[model samples]
Target: MRVLGVDPGLTRCGIGVVDGAPGKPLRMAGVGVVRTPADADIGERLVLIERGIEAWLDEHRPQFVAVERVFSQHNVRTVMGTAQASAVALLCASRRGLPVALHTPSEVKAAVTGSGRAEKAQVGAMVTRLLRLDAPPKPADAADALALAICHIWRGTASDRLRQAVAAQRLRTPKGTA
Candidate 1:
């Protein structure tokens, strides 16, 4: 299945698309960022975000979307913009009746780099390796977004994977086993 991962920011939103299948590597469909003017009002920026997400959804047709959950950075202004950007991403996914799951930053980092506290550069490095690309994914923000997507592809609950795990366990156990 195709999953779209999003990292929402006030000035730039990161987006990554990956296909998830058990025992198979993540297929990097695309990676990018949606940039908004720093001086623009929040409302207009939100509109741009919404349009960008919608465009990605229409183009990629991902089965699901995973977005980074909001966390306050202490600065009220920054927090507000992150929230708005996040809302636009969620709204875009909801509009298509797609199930959207949220993952925390630490969770994304751990999934990508074996450490929850991995730096942005580390995450970018692992993302580059995971995708088998020689050059790092362009633009730090976009690269981070792609890493977030890769995290979800690795750790997100996939129905088929779950079903297969259950089936395997059942076969290994005796009848009526607990």
Candidate 2:
């Protein structure tokens, strides 16, 4: 499956496309960051981000989109910008009818590096190693976006299977108290 992972930020949102499945070698289709002027109006910045994400979606044609879940930060302004950018990403994928998944930083780290608390450098190194890239993606954000895609491709499929199995079991169970 091909997944477009988004690491959303107002000033610099990272976007990456990865193609692979569980137990297979993942390949990087593309990776880049979308930058918006810090002084730009919030509305304009969001529009810029939306347009950039749409372009990536159109170009990569990913079957699924994995976005980094926004976590609260001490700086409210930063958090708000991230949340806004994230919403734009979600909207883009929804409009295209692509399945969307939200993965937290810790979840992506754990999936990629076998530790929830892995450092950024570790994650970057692992991402480089996993995709067999000659060097790590720059600015950390690009590598982060790739990591999100890698995490979803590896874990999302298994999660989907588990959900299906549970649904199947529910269908077989009669209506009664457990």
Task: Pick the lDDT winner.
Answer: 2
Report the lDDT tens digits of candidate 2 across residue range 9-91.
99999998999998999999999999999999999999999999989998899888899999896489999999999999988
Error of 1 at 148 (Å): 1.9
What's the lDDT for candidate 2? 0.90
**Count of clashes, each model:** 0, 0
Worst 10 residues of 2 by lDDT: 162-171
Q: Which stretches of candidate 2 lie over 4 Å from their true place?
A: 159-178
lDDT of each: 0.81, 0.90
Q: Candidate 2 versus the native: TM-score?
A: 0.89
Query: lDDT per residue, candidate 1, 1-178, as tens digits?
Result: 7888899987889998888665688678988999999889878988888889899999999877889888886689888888889998987876555667788989988988899999988988898888887888878877777777777667776563554355446555554532
- TM-score of every candidate relative to the true structure: 0.85, 0.89
* Model 2 residue 20 distance off true place after TM-score fit, in angstroms: 0.6
Stretches off by above 4 angstroms in model 1 are 158-178
